[model samples]
Target chain A: MKPIIEISGISKRFRISHELQPYLNIRDRVSQIFSGKKATSTEEFWALKDITFSVEAGESIGIIGKNGAGKSTLLKILSKITPPSSGKIISRGRIASLLEVGTGFHPELTGRENIFLNGSILGMRKNEIQGKFDEIVDFSGVEKFLDTPLKHYSSGMQLRLAFAVAAFLEPEILIIDEVLAVGDAEFQKKCMGKMDEVSKSGRTILFVSHNMGAVSNLCSKAVLLRDGKIAMIDNSSKVVEQYLHDSVQMSGKRRKTISALDKSFTLQLPYWVNNAGEEIPSYSFGSDYKLRFDFEFHRELTFLNIGIAVMNKDGSRIFTSHSVDDKSFQSFSTYNGKMTFDAHLNIPDLAPGYYQVLFGVADEHTHDYVNASSEVEVILDIAETHKIKDGANGILWHTGQWKKVG
Target chain B: MEYEIKPAGRFSLNLSELWEYRELIFFFTWRDIKVKYKQTFFGAAWAVIQPLLLMVVFTVFFARNFTIESGNIPYPVFVFSGLLLWNVFANGLSNAGNSMVANANIIKKIYFPRLIIPISSILSAMVDFLISIIVYFCVLFFYGLQSTIPSILLMLPLSLLITLCTTLGAGSFLAALNVKYRDFRYVIPFLIQVLMFMTPIIYPVSTPDMEWVRTLLLLNPMTGAIDLIRSAVMQVPVNQTAVAMASVSSLLWLIIGISYFRRTEYYFADLA
Candidate 1:
């Protein structure tokens, strides 16, 4: 079969201002136009220096990268969300994307109204969407609240319905950004299943996500991006394995930054590893496991309270736990000493989830806080039968039992 | 079939293909409407309210208090007729202005005709125009004015053409400016504010006796539209020469606008 899309020698560069170049107000512009002197100096940033790759029909290609690595930019280019500078991109099919969940949705519109709205945005005909309406709503499980204004629904519900509408619409090619990070695991799994089905049905898919495990499981091929270039593109496993390597390496870069708004020293994690040298697993809600973080301090630090906030996929504070009041690490007077902190709590009452935990170190005396090492993502693949929470970020697992005092 | 869509350079707009994408146009239009009226308590009736209320204001200010001219017609009917024509054109132009930037999410994440956004925005305003026109006729009847069939025939298509030209020209100019200098987003609304009063929506074209003012105002394409509309409502014999001159100028603007827009369309998705 002829390749449905062909991209070769594609390059993109964005001009960045060293400083914000204020647009001349009408008066200033009039003067400048008349005077003809250069009013400002301009700088450039190569968002995508030189990119070259291709994908065949029915292939689910995952794009992975660090922030500003041009993963989203490449996806945007592929999806025709924007134009590429100084390069040629040749595509020969219809494409759909959920760049941001619920983008085309109006908060005042109900679920049913938004479905039609979103379907059309994806290029599906009204009749075509009308025919598939039931399946989309049923899949989203928003049928009960279909008539309610979407603003009343939880953010997760809005994401679920938006994804449903985009996924169900029949497009020859599909592009999806990190939108899958929204909603719970069961819903994400359902979304992945739908994407997989679409790929198998001979549609081309380009996916950009930070979720390495999802990329490995759902995509046939993957591209790892770094510094706005294609660092690696191969079979999903190889790409993900390299991605995992890069993620692990990042934690080791050992950068220093002061947390703003307080005199807290935060160590940026360049890479992370478990005791076995295995990258930390992707996490979901209520996962049964333990995580450990090791950090070093320059100044003689003492009397510190440590708290780790496990942020779910949405950057929410899923939960925070701390070391006890009298807790003291194996102290050291010198620079080259390691303090290992262990968290052994069974994550409970979380929606089927994926999470990244941020570890913070603070001076208990002056309340000086520092961001320390963080665990790489850990995934908990729970079965759908554990669907207990109804569209909420159920993070609390209350262990207290009630006694019949009456 | 194998497809590798890396850069969005290969998009080609086949008109026949856009026919297939008509549902998309309809959906985008509906989305615009929902977004506009969603939080408002008045709902779809608000579409009627804008031009109607403006008509009331125009009637009280210019038509009643000031001696603005409409050929052989009461001031209320004249100003409302002009409002009907100008309101639709302004709405279309405004939609075209912001359409590219507003759909940045969709444009960045998928591949469709980039032209579709502005076109759909203009299409959506057609619904509002239809809604308000119903009110236009009611006011017409209250004034005991009758629109001749021939006049209506000539004016309707002429007004649409004028709208097409002015919206395409001004919207394309604004869309391009919105990219490099996003300040145009603010500038556009203010420009429209000055534009509304400048057009004959509130006041009819100055009488031929004040030919200089008419000549200067005729530079605005909507001026021609308002004239065609007045001729439609009052059954006054239109100045064929002036109407013809306006039509020629509108077509010229249409060509220039589309050309500029096509030249700049390639950069929109990138900067927007």
Candidate 2:
């Protein structure tokens, strides 16, 4: 069977005016020819260069790219919003896209009419649309004001209605481009639920999002678009790992600095089971995250204290852990030896992102700092979008739930 | 097997595809109408007001002492008939010309036929035209104008068809050009003003006995349309020859305009 969406050797060239290019007035236009001056020169910019891909039926594909990566341009071509400058596209079925929510709702038309209007534009038959009308309204959660004109609806309300209509239509192929990132977390979950159902029903989906967590969760396979070309295409786990590595490098990675070893104190990560052993990649959230430290001592006595602070991407500490703070086990009294300190942590409550962590070893009296480290990228892949079927829990991992018996 | 790219870009006038999107056309047309009249104190009566004011101005200055040799019809009736056709023509033309540019966001982001933009703009003007027709009916009754029953009925659709043809031709033509040239906007309204008189809107084509002059005026398609409308309202016999002339000419212009529009429309998302 032929793939539902086939893109072959496609490319697009756009002629863009250079801002700094000098302009010639109409009177000067003729003078340039006689004066031997170049007039109206252009620069050809390839927005998408020689790209090809295909999606089989019932497949969910994620497209990830940085800015100017041609992710959106590729989707626009697939949806037939714009034609490619070269090559051909053979698509087997109707395509419904929600590049932006509530795209063409007339402010004057009531929510009810706009629904039908949007439905028809997405290529649903009138009678066919009428049957799903109530479901669309209910999913949108804008039923009470269905009779009111759409212009009066808030942006969120409009987005709700728009997304509900698009997702509910069940087109043979669906194209989504970063629109879901606008809605609140709850609505994103709701959309994720619907997308899950749609894919299960054997419709193809091409989703483009910068949010790596959403991509890895919702997509079975993924493509990393870089500089108008397919940089990589692999399973969600592999692609996400590569994407996060790229994200880590882009967010201004660690700068070269003098190690504070000559000072009274220093903090360094303890390497335990790194396969290559140079520096283990930072652990992700929800995984059994382990932070190991090589605790060193030059001259130490008794009652020594040390604490580990895990700060979010912005350096706000979610919570801190202390070795001395938790007692009844043991205390530190050492001389000069490198000892491994392993703090195994199951981090569940924190959101998925890059964060900073600092480990400091300090004492009660001398007021001397022993060690410190900063800017480690801990990428946490949130629970996958369709994890409920796999018996996965909610957004935040649960420690326990209470039950009452009367 | 891959074929070489052809520059003779195939015009996709897929009506069935448009039929699938019929609801969007209606919704957008509804959008234009609602936004047009909403919050205005005059309500939908503004439709009647605009043409009535133009009618009064034409009646006062142009009709007061003018005798331009209409086809045996009174001056006010002649001007009013012309105004009726011109109102629809002008309103539809302006609205459709700017519809594509005005809905730039939708045009760029969504996947709908950009052709629907101008077509819906023309459709929205029907509301105003229908309302003003009632006013025209009263004006005809008060003056005791002999309403040509057969001709009026037959020519109403004919006049509308001509108006639609002119609008689609001019509107689509301008809409594509407007994307490329911002300067066309300033030139358009001024051009419309000159076209109003050039089309014999306020006067008949020419004296009945002036053979060359009448023939010259017949070259204008709107001349045929306006003359047909006047002949209908004033209970005159049909001019099949002039209409045959106008229909052929107007249809040619329509084809030329749409073909030019199709050639340029592919670049709109980039240029606009």
Candidate 3:
């Protein structure tokens, strides 16, 4: 079978201006034209270089990359939003791109009118929108505000409405960017399910996202981009693993000593470990864990606070634990000698996801914090074991048992 | 198979592709019209009020102070006729010129005939022009003037066609140029102001005594269309030479505008 879309050696170059200002006024431009002064200086940036790919009909391909790795640029080129600087692309069948949720929604227009407007903007015919209008509204769940102007709806409601309109587009080939990064977790799951149905319907899909789990679940193949070039392309799971391994290597060794701070205090750590004192890169849910830190005090200190913060992958702090909070360790003082301290934490029954640990030391009295170069960052991957059921929600699970009280 | 996209040549109008996206053009025009009146208190009434009030100002100031010729018609009716066509051209030109930059978000995300933007803006402006024409007819009715109703009916549509063509020509040029130069943003309003004086909106085409000045005004494409409208509606004397010249010039501007627009359209997404 022939490929649905073929991209051959496509590259794009953007002219980067080094001037002090982004744009010049008409007066300056006119004077420059009269004086015959050319532009001061500029450099050429190759956003994509020799990116070649092909997609068979009914194939779901994921384009994974770090920011500025030309993922969005490639999608734009495929969508024909911009012309490539070099090479060619041949595509069959109708193609639709949902680069953003609400590309042309008007605030003054009511939700019903905006549904039709946004539907047409995404290349839907008027009758097609009318035919599916009820389904779209039902999916968006904005029935009460359907007649209200879009400006009155909250942003989340507006996004759902926009996505609802786009969700009904039945093009042969779909190009999607990181538009799923909006809304709440449940809405994201709905969007992912919609994408799953789209891919399963024997239509070609090209998805670009940073969500490794979503990509692995919905895409059969994945392409990793690094430095504007194709770094790897293979099965989704293998590609995701390779991408993560490359990232872990890029983050350097997990353990290091901090001597650049005030020499009076030296700090060291072995990052993350389990109850058995063995270093761990991952742990099962509901396990006991410890983050060990070694501190050497060259001089006696009045008061010091060591804190550990757990954050999700998006860098939102989940919780913070401090040594000063412990009743037994509150009045404990360190002498002019080395000592090992560990913060024992029970990994809350978290929904299977990635988390990071941030360690810091502060002077409790003066409110001064240590400016250490070797700040420790440990990534903890929590996997769901056979012990938990599938109906769990949110980041944390309460330890209390549930009962059929009714 | 390979689909290549180089910089399009000067002649690539791709009219068939535009024809395929005709429904999108309709939607865009509808969207502009809906959004234009969505938030306003007076809504579509502003369309009639704008030109009607302008006619009043021009009649009181120019017709009274300068004793402008109305060619056997009342001053208010004569000037209102001229203002009707002028409003369409002026509004269409400005709206079409700014449509591309204003819709940059959609342009950056999707691919469609870029010409649809300027065309839809012109169509929306036509809606306003149609509303204002009703007021012009009422002004004639108030003046108790006997209009050549059949001729008016026949010539109004023709004159509007000429106006639409001229606007598309100039507006498309400005739209494409505004994407790259951006100076056209300022230049358009200034040019429209100067053009109103040159197009005989408040004065007759033959008001100037000098033969050369009359010929100069006839060089403006709007001159012939406005002359055609006044002659057909108010039964004014027609200048065949000026009308012929104006018709030719309007078509020429249309060709120039579309050709320039087509040449620069491919770069619009990048520049915008």
Candidate 4:
């Protein structure tokens, strides 16, 4: 079977001039013309370079990258929103891009009128939109307000209506770029289910999103981009794993520079260690691990409090542990001059994959912490050691006690 | 279904792509018309009232003050016919000139034939043109001016076509220029004001007995269009040279405008 989309040697160069304004006004242009002064210097920056990739029919490919990694540039080129500076893209089927929802929705027009307008703007035929008008209204769940002007609708309702129009676009290939970032969680889930259904029905999908879990779950293969080039092209799960591992290493380097700059007191980078004091790279899932944080106080201190928070890859905190929560550890407030303290944190039942450990220090009385406040991120990798099938659903892998009641 | 996208030529007029997006053009035009009169108190009546009010002011100021001969037709009826077509050209030109900036949100997000924006702006103005035409006929009837049905049918369409072409050409050119320079935003309204006087909408083109003034007024592409509509309704003989000049100038403007627009439309999403 032939590939549905063929992209070869694609690159986009943006000429960025460091001017006072992004756009020139008539006065500046007129002055330049009369004075005969050449325009300011401009630097050519490549947003994407030599990006060659192809997708087979019925394949769902996820393009994963960090911010400014050229992911959006590649998608825009494919969608024909912007032309590449060099190279060509041969696409075999009609491509509809949903880079943003409600591309041409008019605020003064009614919901019914906007549906047709927005549908046509998305490249859908009038008859096709008419056929799916009921379905779209049903999907958006805004039937009661169909005749109401769009300006009266809440922003969320407009978003749903916009999303509904895009969802029904039956193009052979769909290029979506982070459009799911907004909307409520329930609506997001609905969009995901709809996209999954579309992919399963033998259509090509190119998805670009920051949600690694969604990318891994929805796509069979993934392309990891770094610095405007393809870093890896492999199975979705493996590429996500590689991306997480490399990201942790980068954050680790950043962690060092942060701690090294502090002169008043030294706080060593947090790491996982076994009971024997040997540092370990990863901990087993559903097992206990000791988190050691060593800090040296240069001067006398009082009411010093410490806290730890474990966050998942998405930067959402799973749980937090504060030294003030424990009655025994609360008294170690005063620190003599040049005294070193080792705070051992024993956290258990974390699921597999990488997490960021946030360590914070505060003062209860003076409220004068480390230059106001400090939170250091340390990468914690956990390996899968769960005996249960399919591992776990959340960050925690706790095995609760189950007993029969008489 | 299969297509290859590459760097487009600077002067490629991709009409097939424009044809493919015809529905979007209709939707855009419909949206404009709906939004234009959405919350207004008089609604479509404003289309009639605008030119009627302008005619009333011109009759009071120009018709009574100057002894300008408008053939056998009443001066109010004569000026109303010119205002009908003139309003279409002026309003269409203004709307088209700003269409690109007005729809910057859509341009930045999706891909479609960018010409649709300017073209739809012109089309929306035609709706008002139709409304104003009906009101002009009522004024013509009030003045007891009778125009042959065949002449009205033939001349009205020809005159409208000329006005449409002139507006499209100039409107699109201004739209593209507005996106790049933004100076045209202020320049367009001023240009429209200058063009209204230059087109002989209030006074007869013949009133300026100087050959140079008459020639200069005829040079404006809109002069022929407004003259054609006025003569067609008033049963006055049309000037062959003026109509010929209008056609050639309108065609030139159309080519220059569309070519410039096509060359620069690719950068609109970035610069708009």
Interface RMSD of 4: 1.0
* Native contacts present in candidate 3, fraction: 0.52
Candidate 3 local lDDT, B21-125, one digit each (tens): 888899899999998998799999999889889988988888888878787887887888788889999999999999889998899988888999999999999
RMSD of each: 10.9, 12.5, 9.7, 8.2
Per-residue lDDT of B198 in model 4: 79
lDDT of 2: 0.71
Chain B TM-score, candidates in order = 0.87, 0.90, 0.95, 0.96
Off by over 4 Å in 4: A20-39, A252-347, A355-406, B148-150
Clashes of 1: 26
Q: Arrange candidates by TM-score, highest first: which order?
A: 4, 3, 2, 1
Per model, state how many residue pairs clash: 26, 8, 0, 0
lDDT, model 2, position B186: 76
- Predicted complex 2: CAPRI docking category: incorrect
Write one digit per residue (lDDT tens) for candidate 3, span A1-406. 6788888898989898786456888888888899997646789999999988889999999898766789998998888888788878888768999999988998988999899888988998889999999999999999999999999999999999999999999999999998886676689889988999999999999999866666778899999998789999999878876665554454435455674256677877535577777766666677877777777888787677787777664435688888788887756655457877778876666666666566667776634355431124455667666555655667776446879988
Tens-digit lDDT track for model 2 on B1-272?
A: 22222122588676785776777788678878878987789989898888778878877887677756655666666777888878777888788777778888777777777778888998998888888887877777777764564567678887678768877888888888888887777767887887887778777765546787677667667778887878787676767777877777778767877777877877777677
Model 1 residue runs over 4 Å out of place are A20-40, A254-406, B1-14, B47-52, B68-71, B147-150, B202-212
Which run of 10 residues does model 4 chain A get worst, by summed lDDT? Answer: A366-375
Where does the lowest 10-residue lDDT sum fall in candidate 3 chain A? A366-375
Model 4 agreement with the true structure over A1-406: per-residue lDDT tens digits:
6789999999889998776566788998899899997567789999999999899999999998766789988988888778888999999999999988998888889899999999999999999999999999999999999999999999889999999999999999999988886676599889989999999999999999866657877899999999899999998988877877776666434444223233546666666777677666777665566776666666666666677777675546688887778777647656655443444555666667887566666767523244211233466788766467664567677667879998
CA-lDDT, candidates in order: 0.69, 0.71, 0.81, 0.82
What candidate 3 gets wrong by more than 4 Å, as runs, is A20-39, A252-406, B1-11
